[model samples]
Target: MRETPDTPSPRSRRAFLRDAAAAGLVTAVPGLAVSACSGAERTEAAAASPHPVTPAASSPAAGLTSNGYGRTAADYARTGLTPGTVQQWEDGFRTAAANDDPDVFEWWYSDFTGDDGTVVSFTLSTRLDDGFVPEPGEDRRRPRSAVIVTDPDGTSHGGTQEYDWSEFSAARDRCDVRLGPFTFTGDLKTYRMRGHSGDVGVDLTLTGLVPPFRPGTGVIYFGDTDDHFGWLCVVPSGTVTGSVTVNGKERSFTGHGYHDRNWGNRPFPYSVEHWRWGRGSVGPYSVIGADLHLREQYGSATVPVFLVDDTKAGKRLVGAYDTRTVTATESAPVPYDDPAYPRDYYSKVHWTYHDGADRADFTFTDTGQRIVSRHYLTSPTDAQQKALDRLGIDEIWYTRYATDNDLTLALATTHAAGSGTGTLEAAQFGLADAPPRTGSSAS
Candidate 1:
């Protein structure tokens, strides 16, 4: 298992910040908008097949936090929580001990896409060692935030903002979280969000089109220590109506939107190689899914779960054994090298899915790359870096891609086909940046 990226104690707090500042670690702003020569996006067709792991015979029971752990919805049901939002974003854990663990992390996430091909995403998140919980004796650790607003043309303006613990707050009763200049508030039915960094400012509102879908106790404990992590999909699919302003020009946009909550004890890469997740809208049908490949020791807990709103069956949640992911080919790999990197990484060309008898396909091509060498630069302290080094990791790659859909639903007596459009991505972690290379790494 990968090591947690956190500072264990507050004893050397001042020296920690000084070293981070010295290595340009504490700053969160992204670099200038120049295209950093991305690799190609086409070529060798990979044979298609379902993920190697077979489906599980049984699934965990779904319910409220009776055992102090929230569960995923076994089937679609209206969430009884207040409309605006659940306390998951702020108070996601079942125990005060987990909440106070600096190793734990939480973030409110949403992605907005304009009809004109502009994509904007913002996340207000932080590791919990310091004072994330505001209480008489709580630790007062600040949080870090990141925002990226990229247009179809590749023009972008956005970066990260590190906030002092005093500037972060989340309502105990609703989905109101303030991280310095960024604020996200509203019930799950509707939410207003605002954030400004560098030369970019994003002001958008998400209105629900589909009711919230919570999987059976969303939390999962995969390690020997049983540290748990969970996700809540407040707005599985929604409508985005707002504007993204870059420089002084503002562009209004309208499209489908997605908002969700992610909180856990370890970064995903620690256990998962990567995950393919996306939400698409076609008429009244809202489609979404998540396929995961667990890395090494964490393979035992891998599962695939997807939610689809069908006019005939309403909305139902399905498990991995109930679904299949087949890759017809892989696009050119967006090259990077870190001499100490581990694992063999490759691009996914056109990925197809079959949910039991229903089916859909999406084709994605590399559009842009976000190179945040921050993770590899130095993780807060020499000790943290050394720990990461033992894991054979350094840099991470998040390459954005546009998606085209081809689908054949089994809803009818016979499989029926349809088409749609959206976005998808590929993530590479714990690898060193290599000299520019492209194409498949196949022999």
Candidate 2:
């Protein structure tokens, strides 16, 4: 059994902010600090799988305050809350939060997989900070965008760019955002996105096939503090018709796509230890799953959220938030190249959701196609690097994998089983101390 680390006392918010500023952790754009490096390519081989351990069932501890964290079905029933409803304004720009504090951050994300095996993903983000100390006529709240395109032949092309704030604008009443030459606009039913990075450009239209979904109130509060994280799947499953231009050559195609929005008031390292998020379309069902592990200060809780939409029947089969009903097991550990912590990370994960007679199982296995791998703290100054060491923030690694998915669903008298391709992401903010490495490791 994996041992749970001891819970640490909560850090003062003011002190955290001080350290963050000292380390130059704040930036004009979110997710751009990473140092991009590709992992070694390897083929899959059969290995012995570890025994799965079931998570202990626990009721909400006293004084726990949250909308969707560590709550059971009965708890939600008392609050008269069902799955979730789409609010037009929820998909709009989070102007209030973005302007409230420098620590708050927001971003829009979308991706499409063509029928011919090409994949395109992109993000538009608001600033995470005004500036370390602004100079005259300097606006650090500039908007930024990134794009990644992987052709069917396995060639990848993409990059990131930051734009002046004057070139950025967003509507508060709907899903309309413009950053330089990039534009992402949509209602609940349909969306249009366009962006360019380096030699690649994408213009796509996505029509929704699954209704929008939120686990509960769409927000997870940390204890009694005002700090929280929010997420909404605007386009769970959609059809995409678009053209991708690469190296002065343009090609049009039809494909499937997914989009979602995320916003939070606190730095992710301070709240989240790690998470596994993924979505897929199998047979007649569209499924999305996330397993979030909170930091020790937040009771080290594991929150599992899942949604299964029956597109053929035009109804949702399950919208689960309770950790007791939804569970995840990680296996098939593989060592990655982290000198500070020579530990193995899981390359295979299985998720299961069951309530009474209804049950669903989804498994994702990495096929060795690592599209992204980077260290979050890129090119820190000498003083900033020292501050990071003081805070025990060693290596923050983010990796994305192209995966093969196997899904089985049995709801009442309906049954479905299928396999497909999808995307899975793993992020590590911190790790326990490990012995010094005597040799190199492979991913």
- TM-score leader: 2
Off by over 4 Å in 2: 1-64, 67-83, 128-141, 337-341, 381-391, 433-443
TM-score of model 1 (CA atoms):
0.64
Instruction: Give the top-scoring candidate (lDDT).
Output: 2
How far in Å is the alpha carbon of 405 misplaced in model 1? 3.1
lDDT, candidate 2, at 29: 27
Writing each residue's lDDT as its tens digit, candidate 2 over 282-310 gives 87788788888886777888888777877
Q: Candidate 1's residue-wise lDDT over 244-321, tens digit each?
A: 888878878787677887776555545555455555655455666555555567543434545555423334322222
- Model-by-model lDDT, in order? 0.51, 0.66
What's each prediction's TM-score? 0.64, 0.76
In angstroms, the error of model 1 at 283 is 6.0
**Candidate 1: worst-modelled 10 consecutive residues by lDDT:** 50-59
